[model samples]
Target: MPYRILKRKDLIPGQTILMVVDAPMIASKSRPGNFVILRVSDKGERIPLTIADADAAAGTITIVFLVVGKTTAHLATLREGEDILDVCGPLGRPTHIEKSGPVICVGGGTGIAAMHHIAKGHHQAGNRVVAVIGARNKDLLLFCDELGSFCPEVLIATDDGSRGHKGFVTELLKSRLEEDKEIAEVVAVGPVPMMEAVAKVTLPFGVKTTVSLNSIMVDGIGMCGACRCTVGGKVRFACVDGPEFDGHAVDFQELKMRLGQFRTEEKISLEKFRGQS
Candidate 1:
């Protein structure tokens, strides 16, 4: 069955489509950090997106996306009440949450949507949640106000300091770690480089850190080897094993290269499609 687009918004100048899918059961099972593979048309490219929001009773799930390629650009053309060809799952492992001392949640770019559930979980578990969200600029900062509701303290950072601190989220994390030595766990989700930097900052201090990874995933279910990563010097598949991993142990340099593999092609696709529009 097709999923009806309930609403669409320009979240941080990109596209966020809130679709009411037919899979009521799937919506009920979704958790934070989990994602779904969606196809806009019959021949559309399958894209993996973190489940930003969901309501079981309403049988809806919101997928927030940045139009980065041909598929996403096509998806952006969709309007409310339009139907999508396919949307599968509630996939990937959810972020682990516990009342494990003070939790500082960091999110950047579109990763803030993924971090939303983790922050919500931490807050519900009675942990003191500090959400440090950053974007390139004020316009890039999405969900700042929504995420702030779950966090006791919400720190915003931007490269130009348009709306928050005048530095990267990693810089904010460093200052906070120095000021308060009680942040037991840190969850950083964003671009690979940002997550890597956060991992580096927390490594020496022995601060337990975890990161949400978006490795190359095809099926989003374990059938494909695309989402593979090395952890503890062993191979791990991100789809089945985790979209989350210990930041300190992850080989971020390798991950960075893997993500960069399609940069040239992706840029061309985005440019071509943007030109057509």
Candidate 2:
């Protein structure tokens, strides 16, 4: 039997699917920051999405996804009780959280789903977690209240100042750092550009920073090498090596280029899909 959808939500205009599958192994073993590869049907393309929430007792995992492509949009059309043809593990390396000091978690756009798990983990680790979320505007921002509940502080920012801060999330982090000296580490999950901005802000301060890369992933296993990323002049695969890495060591320029390699195709596909709808 395939994985069945237990629930589905349009969280902030994006598709959020909560699926219940027979993978007791995955739910029992999943830790925060781990992701899974899913296929809607045998002919569907593989896409990677982070686990927003999980309940091991019930053997369920919640995956919140932003419908950004043909596959994702197709996935959003699925309804509760429908089954995903293929659902693979508990993939990617989990982030290590500890009560080291004040931790700031930053998320942008659809990255909130990924950040929520980390924020929860940090809070459980007894770290004072400050969650900062941003989007182009209010509509694109999701999981603010949910993430806020797990963090010591929650800051919202938009490019247009529609919600909280007028500037970017990095600006908010910068101001917080200026006002307080206790920030020990920063974990960011979002678009490559946003993570790069936050990394630049934290680099000079010597604050330990980590970022989760969501570059296109095919096989969740490292064999495909599709999710390859460069860090400290060494190439690594995001799937097996890490979806998380030291922010300071990541070559953002190269990552940005790689992420944009299919921009035109993606845009055309999005446009064609939107036109169909």
Candidate 3:
């Protein structure tokens, strides 16, 4: 059966949206890091989204996404009561939660939605949760208050100084780490460059860090081999093995190159989509 969108709203006008889907099976089983693969229509490409929240008792899964690409721009046009042709999940491995001390959850851009779940999970697991979220400007920012609800301390950063600290999110993380915060573990989700920067900053501090990778994924399962990446000298699939991995062991440089391989095709696809829209 198709998953219906019970509710939908713009978190950032024309840019990002929060969608509540009627997928009880996925909601009941989903964990913090688990994601879902959805198809807008029969011919639309499968778009993978991280589960920002799940209300099992209510039989709904919440997802947040930015309208940056063709598929996402199309998604923004959808309204409440519309149905997603296919939604196959909760897929991938769930995040490993524990009572690790002083957990820092870092997010940039649309990744803040995913980080919200991770930060809350850590807090519930009895860890001191700190959140750092950022965007290009204040209008583009998201989840600051939502994150504050669970995280005891929430920090903000923005590239244009429209709100919060006037710098990259990594700068805030580095400054905080330098202050001798006893951070036991970190969970980050963002653009590849942002995650790479977070990994670089934490590597010197000897802090355990995990980053969720939004690699190219065709199937919600491992059969497509589209979401493969190298971690600690071993090949791993983001769909089945993880959307999360040890930051220190990840080969980020290679991953960065792989993410850009379809730039030309993506641009052409986006242009065609916009024209048809």
Q: Pick the candidate with the highest TM-score.
A: 3
Off by over 4 Å in 3: none
**Which numbered prediction scores highest in lDDT against the true structure?**
3
Each candidate's TM vs. the true structure? 0.93, 0.92, 0.97
Query: In angstroms, how far off is 256's CA in candidate 1?
Result: 1.7
C-alpha root-mean-square deviation, each candidate = 2.0, 2.2, 1.1
In model 1, which residue pairs have backbone atoms overlapping below 3 Å? none
Q: Quickly count the clashes in candidate 2.
A: 0
Error of 3 at 232 (Å): 1.0
Clashes of 1: 0
Give stretches of model 1 more than 4 Å off.
14-23, 264-277
lDDT of 3 at 98: 87
Range of the 10 consecutive residues with the lowest summed lDDT in candidate 2? 13-22
- Across 1-277, the per-residue lDDT of candidate 1 in tens digits comes to 7777877777645544333455566689998878888898786678888888878898778878877678888888888878878888888888887778999999998888878878888888898989999988888887778887778799999999898799899999999999989888999989998999999999877899999988987888888788889887878888889989998888877787887888898888778878977
Model 3: per-residue lDDT, tens digit, 1-277? 8889999989988888999999999989989999999988788899899999999999999999989889898888889999888899999899999887898899999999998988888888999988998899988888888888778788999999988899999898998898856889878999988998999999989999999998889986899898899999999998898989999998998888888999998899999999998
- Which of the two, 1 or 2, has more lDDT? 2
